[model samples]
Target: MDLNTTKSLVTSKTFWGAAVAVAASVAGLAGFTVSAADQITLVDQIDRLIAVAGAGYAIYGRVVANRKIG
Candidate 1:
């Protein structure tokens, strides 16, 4: 696919919607887990999970979008 096609797909509602959904779910889970504890260890774990999930999504989108462009 060409750059135009890739841009079209990346900028589409579906792609954005999915990304947002994934991010939201990760955040929600992290928050829920953290809320159950007052210790720094649990909070750090939740933060780490959220960060990993967020990074994964970002990398995934970048790779997929680049593949489509190429």
Candidate 2:
């Protein structure tokens, strides 16, 4: 994947927002309340984790790649 894809993983708020919304909905249905601040915190933490994992995977791919770009 290209760097833009990795950047998107870090910067795409819509995707994360939708995920959090679904999770919050599920929590609400289960009789658990998720506060706005908590949702924001969850998004921030998940974003950071995704960013780190994406970067690591990119680096690993480069290291293990057997072919060269033209």
Candidate 1 Cα outliers beyond 4 Å, as residue runs: 1-38, 66-70
Candidate 1 local Cα displacement, residue 56, angstroms: 0.5
Give a tens-digit lDDT track for model 2, residues 1-70: 4745554544677788778989999999999999989989998998898889889999999899999857
lDDT of 1 by residue, 1-70 (tens): 4745554444345554555556656778788432223344444555566668779999889877845554
TM-score of each: 0.38, 0.71
RMSD of 1: 12.0
Candidate RMSDs in Å, in order, are: 12.0, 5.0
Clashing residue pairs, backbone N/CA/C < 3 A, model 1: none
Candidate 2 stretches with Cα past 4 Å from truth are 1-11, 67-70
